[model samples]
Target chain A: MKTRRSDRLVDMTNYLLTQPRKLVSLTQFAKRYDSAKSSISEDLSILKRTFQERGIGLLETLPGAAGGARFIPYMLPEEAQTFINELVDEVNDETRVLPGGYVFLSDLLGRPEILKRVGRLLATQYINEDIDAVMTAATKGVPVAQAVAQELNVPFVIVRNDSKITEGPTMSVNYLTGSSKRVEKMELSRRSLPTGSRVLVVDDFMKAGGTIKGMMSLVGEFEGTVVGAAVFAEGRVSERVVAKYTSLIHVDTLSSDGTGITVTPGNYETEVYENNNLND
Target chain B: MKTRRSDRLVDMTNYLLTQPRKLVSLTQFAKRYDSAKSSISEDLSILKRTFQERGIGLLETLPGAAGGARFIPYMLPEEAQTFINELVDEVNDETRVLPGGYVFLSDLLGRPEILKRVGRLLATQYINEDIDAVMTAATKGVPVAQAVAQELNVPFVIVRNDSKITEGPTMSVNYLTGSSKRVEKMELSRRSLPTGSRVLVVDDFMKAGGTIKGMMSLVGEFEGTVVGAAVFAEGRVSERVVAKYTSLIHVDTLSSDGTGITVTPGNYETEVYENNNLND
Candidate 1:
C-alpha cells in the first residue's frame, strides 16, 4: 500500500470530503498506505501544510483515548454564497420547481453536500449576530438547525409534533398551517429552553407561517425572544410576521398549472458575504 | 483565557479526540487562547508531533478555499467499538440530570464543546466501514449526524417527514412512528441516493426500529446497503433488528411507573483505550 505523498494527500482529501463529520485513525491511514507509522506521520504533515497554503479546508486531530483525525470544509463566506446563488438559479425550473405559485426547495435539502453548504451559508450570516440558540420544528427542519448550530457553537432546539414520555412536560401551541383549515398542535420541551434566550428560527419549508408562529409562542412561554428566522424554502403564502430573515432558496408558482415551480435563494449569500465579518 | 500549555494540550487533545471528523481553524483556537495565530500554529505542530510519535492520533488539514485544520481521534476498530459499549456506564443519576424518564441528553447536546466530544466518540467507530453516506431521520438526529459527518468527511443525508415543492419529484415510504402511532410518511429525493450504496444509519433514539427499517427499505429500493446502525439512546421500545449495532447510551425502562428510565452507556471509553491491534 505504498503511495507517493501527492497520491496519499489527494486520495485522503477526496476520501475525507466524501464523508461529512466522521473520523479516521492514523493506524488505519498507516495501514491503507502500507507505510510505517512514521511515514504516515510525515504524510499528514504534508497534508496540513498543503491545506494552510490553499485556504480551502481544515483538518482536525483528536488525541488521547477515543481520538483520531477529521476534516471540516470552510469556504470563504462570499465564495460559498456565490455557489449557493448560482445553484438556486441553475435549479430554476418554472414548471417543476415552482408549483401552485410557490418556490420549491425539497430537492435542495435532499442533497447532503448541498444542504451543508446551504446551512453554512445561512450560518455565516448569523455567526456575528447576537443569536443564542437555533430552533426548528421536528422532522424536516432539523438538518438546517444542525448546520447552523455547528457554526454558532450553540445548542439547537426542536419542537416535536407531539409530546413523548421521553420529553417530559412540554409547552403546547396551536396554529394555522398552510392550506389546512384546522389548527395543528406543536410542542416544545419545557426544560430544554431557558428564559430570555435569543432564538434563531430555521425550518425546511414555510407555508402558512403557522409553525414558526407556534414556535414563537413557545419561545414566548419560555421568556425567549426571536432574534432571526430563515428557511430552506419559503412559500408565497402571506409573510407571517415582519422579522429579520433570509432564505437559502425561494419557491413560487407563476402559472395555473401546479407543475409551475421556480426556486431562487433570497439575497442571503450576497448580504452575508458583503458583511465580510467572518472574524471570530 | 490564559491557560498552561500542558493543560491546553491535554484538553485540546481530549476535545479534538471526540470529533475525529471535523476540522478546526487556527483562527478559532487563537481566539479561544487570545494567542497569536503564529503561536497557535506552533503549539499545534508540537501537539501533532506528539500524537504521531505515540501512534495515537492524526492531524489533517484542508487546503485552498476549504482551508482549516481538524483533529481526528481514532482508535483501532476493536477499541473504537469497546468505547461505545463503555459509554453506557457513565449515565449519572446523581447529577440531577433525570427529568422524567429520559436521561436528559439536553444538557449534553446543549453544550457545543461536549457535543463535539460526543461526535468524535461515534466517528471513531465507523471510519473504514466503507459507508458511502450517513443517514438519520430529521430533528434531534440532524445534529448528531452533523457532528459525526463533520468528523467523517462524508455526506450526511437526512430524511424528512413532509415533502416540500422545491425537491421536485420525491419517493416516500410509510413507516410506523411510535410517537404518532398511525402510519406516517418519510421522504427523500428520487435522485439524491444511488442504487446499492453502503450507508451508515444513525439517530437520536431507537424505539421500534420502524423508521430505521423504513429507511432501510428506502435505501434498498436504490440498491443501497446498511453498513452499520447507531443510536444516541436505546430507549423503552425494543429494537427492530437483532443485528449488531453501536450506541452511545442505553435507556432502559426501570418501571412502567411514571416512565421510569435507567441510563447506562456501554464500555465505550475502555474499548477505545484497550485495543492495540493494527498498531502500525
Candidate 2:
C-alpha cells in the first residue's frame, strides 16, 4: 500500500501523540506506511526536529537493528510557569474559599484542557522514573491520576475510602486525616497494583499530606515502591507529615471569614524545572 | 518566518487533535505558520483526507469568510465492534464473577488505554448532539465522564452520593436502586453545571440503570436536559429503569456457582452504527 509523504506525516504524528512514551520501531512504521526504511528514517528526523522546535515533546530516535523512536511528553519551563500562574490566578478568588478553609477546585480539576496541561506538567516531573502505575485516592483524585497516567502510558489504581462489592477483594489502611486528626480508612483492590511495581501517587489537593501518606503506605502493602508523590494544590499547614512531594499551587492563607485568601505557585520550579531535561 | 509543509502538518495535526471539535480558521493557521492562506487550505485538505482515511476522525471544512475546519472525533463501526468484542472477552472469565454476581472490572477501568478507547467509543455515539457537559456518579464514573468529555471538548460534572463541605451548596435527589430496591441519594454542586445545559450521563456499568436515572433527574434540578446516557457494560436485570442508552457489552448470565458466564455486545451496533456519520 503506497502512501504519500504528507499523508504519512499527519497519520504518524497522530499516532505518536496518542502513544506517548511508547517506542515504535522503524520497521513497524515502514511496514505500516509501506515505505522504504530510509524514507521512514527521514520522516522521523523531520518529526523529531518539528517536535523539539515546537516544544510539543521530545522524539528520541535510536539507530541500529533494534532502533526505534519514542515520544516523551514535556513542557518548556516558560510554558509551565505561565500555566501555573494562570492556575494560581484562577483560584485566587475570594468566593472560591469555602467553609473550613477548603478551596473549591472541582471546577478547575474537571476541565479536560486544564487536566491535560496539569497532567503533562506533572508527568514531566517523572518522565524518566520507572512508573508502573499511578495511585490516587477516590473521587477527587480520579481525574488527576487518569491524566498523568495517560501521559506516562501506565495504568492507575484508585484507592477508595469505602470498599465496593464490585472490587471483589481489597486491602484497607487507617490513617489520620492531616488537619482533622480523624482516622479514616482507604482501600485498594488487591489485584490492582502488582508486587514490586513502581507507583506515582497523585491527588487533586493536599491538606497536611495525610492522603498522600496513606497512599504511600498502601503502596507498601502491595510491596510496590513509591517513586514519588504529587498534588494539584497544597494548603498551608502547621506541620507536613509527608516530605519530598511536588505540588503546583500553595494556598498560603485563608481567613475563617473566607476573605484574605492568598495563593502562590508551589515548588514546581525547583522540582520540575531543575529536574526537566528540556534544556539538555 | 517560513514553514515547511511537513513541519506544518505535524504541528497542525497535534493542535487539531488536542483541540477536538474546535473550529480553527484558515487565517489562524496561516498566521501561525507564517504561510499563505492557500497553503493553509492545502494543508487542511491533506489532514482531512488522512484523518478520514485513517479513521482517526472527520475534519469538517467550511468554505467562505467565516470558513474554517473542525475535527469531530469518530470511530469506524468495524473498529468499535472489534473493540467491544475484546472488552467482552476480557471480562468473560468465570473468575470475574464475584459474590452477588458482581463482575470485577476495576482493573480494566483503571487502565488508561482501555479508558481512552472506551471514552472514544462512547463519545462516538453522541458526536452530533449538543453536549454542554458530561455527568456521572462519583468513583467509577469519573474516568468515563472525563474520557468522553475530553473528546467532546467539554467539562464534566461529578455527582456525588454524599455531599462534601468543599462543594459549597449542592442539590440532592433520591432514586431507587434497581436490583436492590433500596432508595439512595445522589447530589451535584449547585454551581458546577449551569442552568439549561445539555448533559450526557455515563457510567462504567449498569444493572437497572438506577444511577443513570438519578443523574438524569439531577440534571433536571439544574434545569439541564439529558441528551443521552451510556455505559461501558450492562448486566442482566429483570427490568431496566433507563429506557434509552448505549452500552458496549452485555453480561447475560453469571451462574451462582461462578462457572457459567456469558457476555455479548450491547446495542451499540444499532445505536452507534446507525447514528454514526462515518460513511458520510
Candidate 3:
C-alpha cells in the first residue's frame, strides 16, 4: 500500500505502542508501508522524541544489521505520582469502607484504564528484571497480573484457592491468610510455569503480605525464582510478614465505623525516578 | 513541551490507542502539544487514513464545539480469521484433551497477548452497541470479561460461585452446568451494575451455553439488559441453550483417548467482517 510519511509515522507509533519491548527493523516497516528506509528512520526519530518528551517511554534504536527499534513503556515519576494521587483520592471515599477494615477495591480494579496505569507503573520498576511470567491469585489479582503481563508481553499464571479438575495435576500450598489469621490453601497448575523461570508476583491489595509470601513460596515449588512483588495498594499494619515489595498506594488508616479512610502514594514514584536518574 | 507536528502525531496516536472509544476534541490535542487546531486536524487526518489502510479501526470525527475524534479498535475479517486459525492450531494438541471431552484452556486464556486479541475480536462485534459493562462468571471467565471491558473502556463484573462478605449485597441465580448436567449457583455484587445498564457477557469457553444464559438472566435480575454474549471457543454439542451468541472457534470433536481432536474457526469471522463492510 502506498502511504505518505505522515501516515507511516502514525501507523508506526500505533504499532510500537501495541508491541512494546519488541524489536522491529526498519526493513519490516519499509516493506509494510512501501516506504523508503530513510523515511522510516526519520519517523522513528520523531517518535522517539515525542515518546521521551511525553514520558510515554523510551525508543531504543540498535545500529546493526540485526538491529531495529524497541519501545520500552514507562511512566515518568511525576506522572506516576499524579496517577497514584488521583487513585488515592478516589479510594478515600467513605462508601468504599467495608466491615473488618477492608476497603472495596473491586470497582477500582475492574476499570481497564486504572488497571493499565497501575500495570505500567509496576512494570516500569521491573522492566529490566528479566521477568518470564506474572503470577497472581485467582480472583482479584487476576486483572492486575494480566495487565502487568500485557505490558511485559509475558504469560500470567492464576493461582486458585480451589483446584478445579480441568487444571489436571496441581501443586498445593498452605499459607496463613494475612487479615484473617487463618490457614488457606492455594493451588497452581503444574504445567503453567516451567522450572528455572523468573516470575513477578502482583496483587490488588496487601495487608500482612501473607498472600504475596504464599505466591513467593509457590514460585519456589516450581523451581522458579521470584524477581519482585508489587501491589496496587498496601494496608498499613503494625508489621508486615513480607520483607520487600512495591505498592502504588498505602492505606494508612481505615475506621471501623466505615466513615473514614486515609490513603497516600507509595514509595515507587521516588524510588523509580531516583533509580532511573542515577542509572542515567 | 514544544513538539513538532511529527512528534505531535506520534503522541496523539499513542493517546488515542490507549483511550479507545473516547472522544478527544481537537482543541485538547492542540493544547496538549501546544499546536494550532489546524495543525492538529491535519495530523488527525494522517492518523485516520493510516488506521483505515491498516484496518486498525475507525477514526470518527464529530464536527462541532462538542466534537472531536474517537478511535474504534477493530480487526478486519481476514485478520480475524488468521488469528482464530492460529489459535485453533495451538489448541489442537492431544495433551489439551481431558476426561469427558473437556479441553484445557486455562493457559491459553491466561496469556496476555491471546486475551488481548480475543478481547479485540469480541469487542469489535459490540463496538457500536451501547454497552455499559461486561459480565462473566469466575474464575476462568474473569480474564475474558476483563479484556473485553478494557477494550470497551468499561467496568467488568465477576459473578462468583461463592459469595464473599467483602462484595456486600449480591444477587444470586441457579443454572444447570452444561458439562456436568448439575445445577449450580452463581452470584454477583449488586453495586457492580446499576439499574437499566446494558452488559455484554463473555466467557473463555462454552459447551451448552448454560453459563452465558445464567449471566443473561442475572443481568435481568439487576434490571439490566444483555447486549450480547461471546466466547473464545464453543464445543460442538447436540444442543446449545443460548439462542444468540458469538464464538471465535469451534471444537468439533474431542477424543476420550486424548490422541485426536478437531478444532475450527467459529462463525464470528464472517459475521463481523460482513457486518462491518455493510456498515461501511
Best by TM-score: 2
**lDDT digits (tens) for residues B1-280 of candidate 1:** 6654433443455345434556778777766667666666656666666555433556776543334567665544454455444444544453323444445565455545555555666766654455677788766676677666666656677777777554556778887765446788888776566667788788877766677777877787677888767777766554354255566676775443434446666334333334421112
Docking class of 3: medium
DockQ, each predicted model: 0.15, 0.89, 0.79
Q: How many residue pairs clash in each candidate?
A: 97, 0, 0
Residues A1-280 of candidate 3: C-alpha lDDT, one tens digit per residue: 6788788888888788888788999889888988877777877888888889888988998765455799887878788878988998998877777777777788888999998988788778876778899999979899899888988888999999987867877888999987778999998988888878999999988999999999999999999999988888888887788998888888755546656788888767766676563122
Give the per-residue lDDT digits (tens) of candidate 3, residues B1-280.
Answer: 6678777778888899889899999879878888777777777888888899888888998765456899887877777878999999998887877776778888898887788888888878986788889999888998899888888889999999898866877899999887668999999888788888899998888989989988998999999989888898888888888988888898855545555778888878766675552222
lDDT of 2 by residue, A1-280 (tens): 8899999999999988899999999889988999988888888899999999998989989997478789999888888999999999999988888877878899998899999999899888887777899999989999999999999999999998987988878888899899889999999988788988999999999978999999999999899899999999999999999988989999865656666689999988777687653223
Least well predicted 10-residue stretch by lDDT in candidate 3 chain B: B271-280
Least accurate stretch of 10 residues (summed lDDT) in model 2 chain B? Answer: B271-280
TM-score of 3: 0.95
Native A-B interface contacts kept, per candidate: 0.28, 0.90, 0.81
Segments in model 2 whose C-alpha atoms lie over 4 Å from true places: A275-280, B274-280
Best by lDDT: 2
Candidate 1 has an lDDT of 0.63
